[model samples]
Target: MQINRLFEMVYLLLNKKSITARELAERFEVSTRTIYRDLDILSSAGIPIYTSQGKGGGISLMDNFILNKSVFSEEEKNEILYALQSLSIAQSPESEKVLAKLNGFFDHKRSNWIEADLTPWGSGKDSQSSFSKLKEAILNRRVICFEYFNAMGESRGRTVEPLKLTFKVYAWYLQGYCRTRNAYRTFKIARMSDIVLTEEHFEEREIQGGLTMEDDETSLLSLRLNVTADSAFRVFDDFSETDIQRMDDGSFSISVKLPESNWLIGYLLSYGDSMTVMEPKHIRERLREQAEQIAARYQ
Candidate 1:
C-alpha cells in the first residue's frame, strides 16, 4: 500500500515540476525522513529527481524524464493485472471492496478483473452457526460444549479442549481432548449438535495422531482384513486413498498391518450377508457371536 501511495505521489508530481519534502511530509503525515527515503528509492529506479540549493529549494525531476515502458514489460503489466483480478475473485471478504479499484485499473490495461467475487458462502447464502461458533472458539482459544454422536450413534455431552479443526476426506472433524474419555477424540462436525463456546479457556495442545495435511504413506489407517469384495469400498472409505489396495483375489484385503479392535469386528458384522474371515479367526468368531445375539433377539 505504501508502494501504491508512492506511485500516486510520483504521478501527481508528473503534473508539476517539483514538490518539497515538507509539503509531502505534511500531506502524507509521515516524517520528512521517510519521504526522503521514498524519494531515494524512486530516483534510483530512474525517476530523475534532484534537490535544489537555494532559499526556495525543493525536489525537481529532469524535463525529459518520462514514465514510458521502462519500468515493466507489457507481459509483466498484464501478469500483475491478471493476478490482482484473480485475487478479486477469491472466497474471502476483501474481494468485493476491491472491485471498484479493479474497474478503474481495467481501463489502464488490456486485462480485466472479470465477474469474480469473494463471498465464501456463495450467492444468497451465509455460513451456518456451526461454522461461526467453531471458528469463534478456535479464535478465542476457549473450550466448547457439545453433544457428540460417535460412530455407534451413542450420544454423550462433553467439555473438551478444542485442539484442531480437521477436514477429513469426506467430512469435517474436530480433534480435541476428551476429558471424559481421558484421551484425544475426533468428532465429525455433521454429527455434532448444540455446539456452544464455553467461558473456560483451553491451553494449546499438539494434535499427536490422526490424519495430517500431508498424504504420507504412514499417515493412514492401514488395516488388512479378509472381507468380501462387496465390503471393500466401504472399508476403503474409512482410510485415505494413499493406503487403499486391492488384492489379486478381488477380496477385502489391505497392503499393511491391521488392528485388533472390537470396532473391526463390528465393521465386518455390518456386511453379515456377505463377508468371511480367513486368517483372522478371532474377528470372525466375534462377528459370528454378535450375529447370533441379533438372531436370538429376533427369536
Candidate 2:
C-alpha cells in the first residue's frame, strides 16, 4: 500500500507541478510526516524531487525529469501504454484512469494506433450488458445462467461456471463448465439470452485442451467454392488471399476447410446466388433440399 501511495504521490506531483505536503497527507489520509518520508524515499531513489518553503512553491519535480528514464526503457513504456490502450475496448474506467496517468507520467502522447469494438452491428443495449456481465463473472469467478440456443435452434437454460471469453473466427464465445451437462462447453454469445450473474462462485478448473467449433474432428470438411465478383467483399473478408484464385471472369475460386455442422448449410446458403459449391456433391444436394424446403414454405 505504501508503494502504491508513493507511486500516486509521484503521479500527483507530475501533474500538479507543485502541491504542499499537507495536501498529499489529507488526500492519502496520512500525516505530513509520512508524506515527508515518502518524499525522502523518492529523493533517495534518484527522483529529482525538491520542496520549497517560500509562499509559492511546495514540492516539484525537476523540470527535465522523466519517470520513464528511471523505471522503463522507451520500448517497454510504449508497450505498456499500447496494452492499456487496447484494454480500452473493455470500457474499463479504472484502466482509463491508469492509462491517463501513465501517459502523463511517461510524458508520451497517446497514439490511436489500434481501435477495437466487439459490439456487433445492429446490437442493442442488452448485448453490451451481456458482454460486460460475462466479463465481470469471468473475472470474479462467479457462476452465470443463460438461455443458450444450440445449432439446431433449440433453447435451454444453462448454469455455467464461466472460465474465459474468446473471440474466434467471426463470433464471440464463452468457454465454461456446464453444470447441467457436467462437462466443459463453449457457447456462442450471440445465441445466449436471459443472462444472469449468480452470487454463486466456484474454484477455477484446469481447462481441458482440444476445444473446437465441432466436437467431432472427423466431421471436418474440405471444400472448394466458386464465388462471384458480386460477393468480393465477403470473399476478401472471410478467406485468406492465398486460398483464393482470381478467375478470368473476375470471379474467385476458393479452397478452404471448415467444420461440418447443422449451421454449415445455412451459412453457405447465406451467400445466395453469388456463390456455388464446386466440390462435395453431398453438400450441394443438401443445399438444394434446403432451398426446396424454403421454396415450399413460400409457395
Each model's TM-score?
A: 0.46, 0.69
Candidate 2: clashing pairs of residues: none
Each model's lDDT: 0.65, 0.86
Deviation from native of the Cα of residue 33 in model 2, angstroms: 22
Error of 1 at 88 (Å): 12
Where does candidate 1 have its weakest 10-residue lDDT segment? 211-220
Q: At residue 100, what lDDT does model 2 achieve?
A: 86
Question: What's the lDDT for residue 140 in model 2?
Answer: 84
Predicted candidate 1, C-alpha RMSD: 9.2
Query: Local error of candidate 2 at 287, Å?
Result: 2.7
Per-residue accuracy of model 2 over 1-299 as CA lDDT, tens digit each: 47658878888887887999888999989999999999999999998998889798799998897766556889999998999888888877667877888887788998967787778899888889999999899888999998987765667899999988889879999898888788788888988999999999999887798554313333678999999998999999998998999999999999998767777898999999999999899999999999999999988
